[model samples]
Target: MTDHETNETAAEVKVDRQRPETPSYEEVLFYERKPAGFWVRFWAYLIDLLVVTALTSILVKPVFALVGLETSGVPWYAPYAILSALIFYGYFVLMTKFFRQTVGKMIMGIRVVSLKTDDLSWMTLLFREWIGRFISVTIWPLYWIVGFTPLKQGVHDYIADTTVVHEESFRKNKLLQKKTPDGSGLHETSAF
Candidate 1:
């Protein structure tokens, strides 16, 4: 080849290297993400409270009976509180790690996601569900931050760098309602 031809080929190669590959149709179809808001999260949490209360009651009853603490006039605070904490941590951590949501969140059509990865991790689950939730429950006002934050993040979400999102919207490949890289929120729509 001539010198000019070699130069042209090199430039073509450089251009090809600089161009970004377009995403596949499947990726475009499956990767849409959307954030869940306060009202929905609140309703889901109420449902979760009922579910957890029932579950805790059931589990505690057997333990109380085994410990011979179920008799009338027995003080219930100590075992109840300890078991409640364990149940809360276990329920949140296990369910969110495996299912991406609690029973309540699932019923409300929501899911939790780690901002760092596609799949949830044990550390994230522990922080978000165990420690972060403890803080939020102790300081009840922290939970209300979900109402004012852009992504509806609460103390637990902030601590874990996670978010709650609308499951169907995410699953259906709809456009996300979160802030874009340029920090814009003006383009969110509900096509579902």
Candidate 2:
């Protein structure tokens, strides 16, 4: 080999293109596969609609009249759309940020969680709330599709990379666990 070629080979760095030994990307998907039942999710969504409607009625609905904003007052929309968007966006921000539960999800014992990580962030919640409305509202079939989606996601869930999972009942868990302080089998551990 030429001296220059030998020198070039010696200077070159050998690199192994291998990923780090950690969880796979799929394993870390936020939505997960724990699908919520149809009826369960449906009722929870209804609860959310009622709450949002009530809140929007109080806030956005009044704003139009107060500001003397009318359907003909503007060029584009009937003003109701603006009100709807205000309620839609505002309701989501409040529910996910403050309570971490919309009325429907709370009642049904299901929750929205981030798809990328275990923690639920405001951004994820916002995406889910806004996008979810599109799928959750349109019709029953669409809503069912979300529940049946492989990842347990509705439209918003898919868009936001989020998931809805059933919350384990605390009361049931407490009842089932009659344990000892040292962590032994139930029979020996049962103080109750």
Best candidate (score: lDDT): 1
| lDDT (Cα, tens digit) per residue for candidate 2, span 59-116 | 7767777887663345435667776767777876677667666778877777766768
Over 4 Å off in model 1, which ranges?
A: 1-31, 70-77, 170-192
Question: What are the lDDT scores of the predictions, listed in order?
Answer: 0.80, 0.64
Instruction: Output the lDDT of residue 47, model 1.
Output: 89
For 83-159, candidate 1 gives per-residue lDDT tens digits of 77688778878888888999999898999988889888888888898889889889989998998887789999999
Give the C-alpha miss distance for residue 33 in model 2, angstroms: 9.7
Error of 1 at 87 (Å): 1.0
For residue 129, model 2's alpha carbon misses the true position, in angstroms, by 2.1
TM-score of each: 0.66, 0.57
Best by TM-score: 1
